[model samples]
Target chain A: MSMTHWQAAFAARIARDEPQWLAPMRAAAMTSFNALGFPTTALEDWNYTSLSSIAEVPFTVGASASSTTVADLTPYMINAEWPTIVLLNGSYSPSLSSLDSIPAGMLVMDLAQATREQPALMQQHFGTVATSEHAMTSMNTGLMQDGVFVHVPKHVESETPIHILHVSDAAAAMSAKFPRTLIVAEAFAKATVLESFVGMADVAYFTNHVAEVVVGEHATITHTKIQRESDLATHVSTTEVHQARNSHYVNFSMAMGSKLSRTNVYTVLDGDGGGVTLNGLYLGKGTQHTDHQTRIEHAQPNCFSRELYKGVLDDASHAVFNGKVYVHPIAQKTDGKQSNHTLLLSPDARIDTKPQLEIFADDVRCTHGATVGRMDEAGLFYMKSRGVPAETARRLLTYAFAADVLETIENETVKQALEQLTLERYAGSGNNTAHAAREH
Target chain B: MLEISNLTATAGEKDILKGINLTVNAGEVHAIMGPNGSGKSTLAQVLAGHPSYEVTGGTVHFEGEDLLELEPEERAHKGVFLAFQYPIEIPGVSNAYFLRSAYNAMRVARGGEEVDPMEFLDVMEEKLKIVEMDDAMLARSVNMGFSGGEKKRNEILQMAVLEPKLAILDETDSGLDIDALRVVAEGVNKLRRPDNAAIVVTHYQRLLNYIIPDFVHVLAGGRIIRSGGKELALELEEKGYDWLLQEALA
Candidate 1:
């Protein structure tokens, strides 16, 4: 079958028995997806990562069960403090999840259940943040069957983080899992949510996911998305965040997984004094490829946005970071800064970074910078002279290099945990700590 | 405790130290006075096994062991300390953390027990008082954005913590005022024990007034040309190295 046949098949599957309001929206999204097709390197946004692997996957959309359990995916769940909500093959599995101390007025249930019980609220926010412009997001909306829904009432604050663990374990079946997460924080509310993606070992699968977050007026939200999939899997993730007046949002993305992965993070400051921070760290090893395309729009005046993304590329892996900040003509007093830095660990590794600022306002402070280089030899030698093994010395120096970005994380425990994990990965990639100190 | 015989060192084919011979015994303080490029700092770095300097035809013995055969950190673990002229700035590494790591590395080398965090903090607090440094500096990254006097005081603080047997101070008195000079000298004097020795490498007699030395030697062109009592430092300060060089050549 041709590409148009696959698109038609996806649209036909979603049109049957769907809600009347969502049916027309799904058809519109399918038309946009057909027009866009799959983005190629000719497009500046998809320059480094290719979509051939995702396009070639032979699969059908729907929720299906597999034999994999939570015990089999324990190593990927790095954060044990947060209660886990495991999703097997795109459907929520309560038997494999542990939710004990959730706050009052907060909902963590399946998307279908939320739609059935609170149709009005679900209809108001679902598919609102993720528009129909992007093709992958359209594909996700066209094929999504089951996902996680979270809602926090006005003025309620959650003390602990909410974790949604999405695992694709359909090893025997050729399938595509589209896990959707919709989070709405009411006015004056505070919450933190983490989404982690995992897959079965040695499995060939495709995952198209979307997470839409809506922050009400004067609310605060902190979100983290960690994607670590099987080496043979192909994945595409898109996060759409909308902020109201005087609200604050912080989103951190760490992508260190999959054979081919592309993530799009777009934020809109819809009201005045709304602020956002987008920070990311990506690690690409072997022949893996990763790309991140982010957009932050200052629709109203007096809004502030800052973005910093860093990557460490080794072997023949490639990484791309494209960030754009747009300020409306009347959005005066806007402050925006975007910086992307990459550390090339091997001669064959590659990185492409572009920081674009389109400010129509006359009075604004906007700046961007990009840097890509090797490690500092002087810093390495200084550590080695202190009897730290050369391998350990390099590790310590690299840790220091990345510490500037990691230290900005407000939570000390999370910051330290990620630092330790990054160090272990650095060690596993042949840092040679045994002979580091011998040179001194 | 240490002996250097016919030592010659060079940097980039330029001779810095030429045929120098000196002996430092236990319970003694030897002060080497010289002008700029008189090889005072080169001697200390050579003894500490700095990589930039090439030692040609030199025999260094520390407590009857071949000192040149070991690395700089090994020399440090063997009770030899060099107070650097310029302490390096290590960002993201705390002062207390770096000191504890160095202390434990030394302790492990000598088959001694490592100090826990509480014990280490206690020892650090007690030693910090001698150098007049507050606990706030210990909490910060090592030597980052520190003043000249503060950096010098931090070096003395590290010495007090390590408690090395042989200490070499190279130009430690150059960037200090009167008050800082007295505090640094007092800290050094407090670290001195009967079994420990120190080599004060300087170009002026001002430091010797604060910390008295048993012997004062004149080093010119990498070799010691004159040896005298503590009064020799006074003579060199009265008439600069130019007068001494003229007399030695004559």
Candidate 2:
């Protein structure tokens, strides 16, 4: 389809019953999307990732979400009782969501419901943290229908985490889903939110997702996004965060599926004494292409940011990691460090890692480094000499390379689940070699 | 238990071991004392199937099985171990974890039931004492950030756990303090049995004082130039190898 057709479909989707406040925002975003269109390989950011495959598919848009049952969602759920909110084809499914366990004064509702009931709150923060800088973000903002809206009131610490599950069923094949999530945490509040994107079938589809997070003063938020789409799917997600004074935010993204996937995590430390950590782990196999682009803007003084992304590519897979840390002139005492390391298991596997640091402050301390290497031959031979089979040795070393990123996760339950997944993906071959060793 | 007839090998374009012949019987510890660049370590590596060395001409038999035809892990499973001159560090894999995996792999390959973690821990504790290693070392990454003595001790600890029939110590005494040398030699001495043997390759005879080899061979120019009893090691220690090389040339 051409850009005009995409714009016409967006206009038809927005002509329905949307609030008056969202009308102008949608119009501006639609104009931006029209002007930008789909990014091409000519752009520096998209130079390594091609969108020709995604653009060739005639995706059906503006359709009602396919009906999905609980059985179809069980495979994607990490915790079934964690005040879960499920989105089918980017639209909220009340039959699948279970929000009864949510704490009092903590609001968790669908985006459409929030626009109707909490219009004031939605109007103030929506489309504020995330700008229409990229075509995917603009298209998602203009075309989004329903996603979860979470608001943790001031000083209301949520003990149980909130699970936002996105499942695209078999009926969603040859279609597009734009998922939008906005999370606002009030002052002195603490919460952990996990967003999981999964697909139920082997059909090809496109997922354009955007999430805006606002962290209030002295608040803390732990956000995790796990992208396990179908092997033939295209996934593009952008997480834009704004942190307040003395607030802390950390994001952990794990990408293991999708034939073509790109995730951009951008954060701005707008308040003094704030800190942010963007850590990611990507495992690519079987000709898959995974890209992670992150930027941390230290806009305030006395802020610290750390970013570490590790990738393991096998077979003919390719991975790209581009991370930058930007510090403003007035942001003195800014401590920023970023590094990207990749391990290529096969000679055909490739990785392009670039760690950049742009600092205007003279007194700030910033450092960036990147390394791309193959498996350690000496280490492999050492293991085999100790009686470990060649295949098992490779699995153990691969798992070890990806295990340190799991340490970045603070939640034990989520950490364990991801640990098991990593083990099964890398080390478990009929027998659990590394898992059995860790059982002691 | 082990025989190598006319073994010739090369590393890269250089001949490392040329026309070497040796025989190791059960319950015997043979000391191979050689000068620098004399193929002592190469012989040990070839016996354990180090891929760096290409065996151009050799026939090695271990308990009547063709040792040269097996891979490194298969050689390990058949009770052959080589204590590396410099053990490589494997980050993120704990010492205990590596040992357990290696132990279980050998057991499973031999058609035996795998020992559980608890059972393995019991066996590990017994072997750890032989190397005088603390429990904290077991949890650390293999050979990473370890002291020189600690690395050698870890090698011995593995040998103790694996219980190989033929243990080739390649310069095991290099870069060791007097106390560490004694401890390493004592660990090797304690693990010796009537049915298993060892080949100690070193530059000096200081290690043989504790391990007490039954025979000593002087290797020069990729061949065994001389062979004698353990007293030959002491004589070489006092007289040095210059006279021996001159006598062999004469």
Candidate 3:
């Protein structure tokens, strides 16, 4: 029989001598990944996105990438005082990172080190939070060579945010990179992680990323992910979170550049009185397509979740947002809300939004809605009649649409970075409607 | 310094204003009073170059220049202001930002220096006092969630800030209480200069009590039926608009 596409990639990995126990788990994960394959449009969960373009290319599995420095990551790096873990082509880079300032009682190391040093801990919690329902998660478990792992002990709080940066240096075109991150916070511990994924502007690559978080009782975790890959690159990222009793979880994500990118966030509130907040912003221009999908599961009583996602599309770009919230029967006092808003700046730009709410419990308060709007003509006229120039009005209105959601971000530095990037996007697309009107 | 000769306009092929003639020099406030459906607001809208109103026949001249040829914003840059009856609400744009943008845009068109935010805030605070507005209103979105009186006062505040040559108020007193009417009329009276003129369009004569008009013109059935002194508004208030409608029909 002819071997499948993933089989060859798997064969190349087991060729080297690896950890002893990983052999059986890798075998099982490979079997599941081959069965699942790539999700297609026939599946209702991925109806708006198609993987045909991704499935066509023959991808090379990456081991080592070209040499890069901190200079290549300055654009996407936040200006702050924190310990950062830098990864080049999905592998750890000790030279390009700063680990001297990490706080005490925290275990911040690569997966390989965790597997060797804390063998029992790695055996206990490696795949506990990362699910294997789909191919991407299982594929990462089977073939992921090196990734990031962070653990915060009980009753400790770190003020400085731990930054995990993944910079893709595609030494060879058509190479594929798989990045996995696992974070475990014990009871009453608090930590914040800022994770970013970026690459060169014109490079072509495939990035499959997954992050899983295990939040314990009364523990707090704030995870922010920023995906800004090259326009010729493809990115598929998934985030999974499981919260304990009375724990708190906040997730913020922004998708800026990619030919075809999808960001999926799934959360399960397994304990009572826990809270979840999810906020996202996606910007697409040119022929880029950005998708944001979120699912919040309320399995316990007295839990609450809030989700708001907004998108802006210009040129011939497209965007999609599908958010679902499910409240079980035992979760009677659950409170959940989800809102999706999109603004199309061109006639050819489009968006598809599906907001779903599934509640089996009575006496629960849940609200879900989606809205789509083009530029407001009356608002433009009001600005024009007030003597504001046409182009200025257009830029201001466009900025205001995205700024409304960006203002909700609690991190001041992160908010400013995103705002600058958004302004650059608007300035780059100078042929937008307002400019067209001015030309006429 | 404004002239309208044989001015006619239509909306969707239906004539709304037919054969209107008026003249106003500088240093005057002219009140055009009429009953409902008498096309009182249409004249103010047409003069400001609203796109919905097509000028079928006639000419409007401001400072001896054809005003109809200029865009609405161009007319605004040349010192023409219209206080809308119902101001539109724009969310996510702060009141201070919108005001400064308008001020700077006009200044750029006039080849004058633009005011910085600190300097503009000083100017805005002074104008807000003229319109009896609070400082906190400047931080909120433009006209979003504002009460009826606050919106009207905001319009007057804008008019006060722009300091236009010819200001038109369309039914500015319809939804106002006595206090707001007094504040708005006081603000208007303060803006009058020997070089600028005003046009007040109202359905009632009560607003004339605060700011007296130089001339009272009664309009009926798309035409100005009569013109008199300030006593004309008083006479219409004492009686009703029936006399003017009858006189014009005859």
Candidate 4:
């Protein structure tokens, strides 16, 4: 697991005349990645998720290839009309992506290209928010080849959302892919971006991803990450957000796939009147495992944050939610609320939820709560008394439980689409026709 | 259409209904007036097959079949409806959805096809007007944020839509205003048919004014101590249950 061997080899293989500042940052990150191996259950954050399944993955860094075609990558694209960036095996696939209609003065390109073409701009903001501290993050920073870099200048807004799709088409049993995304919204600017991680094959691969979002004063940003990898793939991603004075930031993460997936979302309200809202929904079935570890820090006065996460566990699948909110000494008038609720359909399925709040300021108002239970018996009885079969009753109740979270999405079309997908996911659980008939 | 024989039931270690015997023919409305904890609700719950109460010795025949042998849902499917006194609040379930499910459940139990949403909505639109309830309540969650009067009216709406053979109103007039009470009573009176019956359980005679009863019975302790025509309700309202309890004891 030493980095000395791979650092020299990676440097020799990459093209010459690359940005000078990136090499040392990558070298230092590789050192940190080597020092800290994969986290284990002994750590409180990783207690419920078992990383031993991915410990022995035979992973090797992949090289860029030009033969990748858009037809091969069409299944993973969510929005075809928006400016698109496609990354294959952690390398930019120029032939498969298009960015024709981007507004003027907005910078949207591969981070690797941004580093080579505009070194000064890349040096000012790259790695500014996501530090190389944890092993997965450090590995992403160390071995990162190509990702998205989006910059919206002051007072500018984009009409359409930027779409970035990351596909892992690796053939090796233990191949590794590292993807990084860096976005900066200047003062009074607005933008929406969606990042999707998908796997084209069912091979056992590992994807380590890191994204950094910085919102300036009076700015607003909405970012969404959708993870739908292969059944045998392991995904670990961290999204760090820093909100400045009077700025608003919203991040949504949906985990529907991956054998062992964990997402860490960290938000910091760094200035006065700043607000951030974090929302997530994870649907796990079969033997899949999903974990969401979220932390929100209120560092200044008049800041607010709300976190709502929900999960539905079926079969023998397991879900974990560890959400923490911190109110610092000067962060008064901070209205923070966190709630995590889960439904365990099968007796064997499990969910571990903990909502933590630490407040040092006496003038702040913060609340946190968590609930884990089966379908409401009274509710089921009431529905059954009406003529709904027991199975349909269960499905309706389950969908309603998740709908409480889906209704929070601000976009009408996205909210409706996600709600339909949520219902379909429940309907796919061996009660399709019954649920479909009930819906009508 | 309904018969009870030796109906003995208990909640925990205390007996609530002791060997209660009564019978109701079709097209009759019977009123049961009792003091607090005199087993008025116990009779309604036991008849509805609530799992909390244990039936030590009882036999209920509804439409010539053993009613106590069936589950609560089965009892409901067999045309036995209990309008709760304190209706349970079900969050996240729409009122329309709840009523449609109940209506379809009863229909399917009788070997009929289930109604589609559009047809069910048409039926709800017609029945909701009977209770003077707005269409908004039907779209909202069942009893989640409804006022007391709204909840009771919603119950009557369910009764109108389901049209059960035996409708048991267990203290449905407790928290209703005068207008809500009149609307609910009118809804119930409209649903009455020669082939259906009702058992109105209450502690006062106020509700009987809106929907006149054919018979009134005084339930003291666990058994009916007196039975008379509708005038008994007016008499009880004038003298109260204490005088009747004293008369029964004497």
Off by over 4 Å in 4: A1-17, A63-84, A88-107, A168-173, A199-203, A428-440, B10-15, B103-116, B220-222, B246-250
Q: For candidate 2, what is the DockQ-based docking class?
A: medium
Off by over 4 Å in 1: A1-12, A59-64, A70-83, A169-175, A199-204, A314-317, A341-350, A371-378, A381-385, A426-440, B1-69, B113-115, B174-178, B201-206, B214-232, B235-250
Q: Which stretch of 10 consecutive residues in model 2 chain A shows the poorest summed lDDT?
A: A431-440
Residue-wise C-alpha lDDT for candidate 4, range A1-440, written one tens digit per residue: 33454555456545545577777887787778778767778877788887776665446667434355788776556556678888877777777788997877788899867887777768988888886367788878877767889999999987577888888764524667788999999999999888888877777778889999999999999987888888888899999888899999988888888998999999889999999989989988899899999989999999989888988888999999999898999999999988888888899889988888999999988888898889888777656554456776777788777767776777654555566667788645542332232242
Please state the interface RMSD for every predicted structure, separated by commas.
7.3, 1.7, 7.7, 3.6
lDDT of 1: 0.81
Write model 2 residue lDDT over A16-104, tens digit each, in one string: 89888898888888889889879999998888998888775678773344767888787667788788998887778899999998878
State each candidate's chain A TM-score.
Answer: 0.92, 0.97, 0.93, 0.92
| Best candidate according to DockQ | 2
Please report how far candidate 1 places residue B53 from its true position, in Å.
4.9
Model 3 — TM-score against the truth? 0.92
**Cα distance off (Å), candidate 1, residue A226:** 2.2
Candidate with maximal lDDT: 2
Q: Rate the local accuracy (lDDT) of all candidates.
A: 0.81, 0.89, 0.84, 0.82
Decreasing DockQ order of the candidates:
2, 3, 4, 1
Tell me how each candidate scores on DockQ against the true complex.
0.18, 0.60, 0.40, 0.32
lDDT of 4 by residue, B67-95 (tens): 98987778878888889887767765567
Clashing pairs in 4: A58-A174, A386-B101, A386-B102
Which 10 residues in a row give candidate 2 chain B its minimum summed lDDT?
B109-118
How do the predictions measure up, each by TM-score?
0.86, 0.96, 0.92, 0.90
Q: How many clashing residue pairs appear in each of the predictions shown? A: 5, 0, 0, 3
Please compute and give the TM-score of the first chain of candidate 2 against the native first chain.
Answer: 0.97
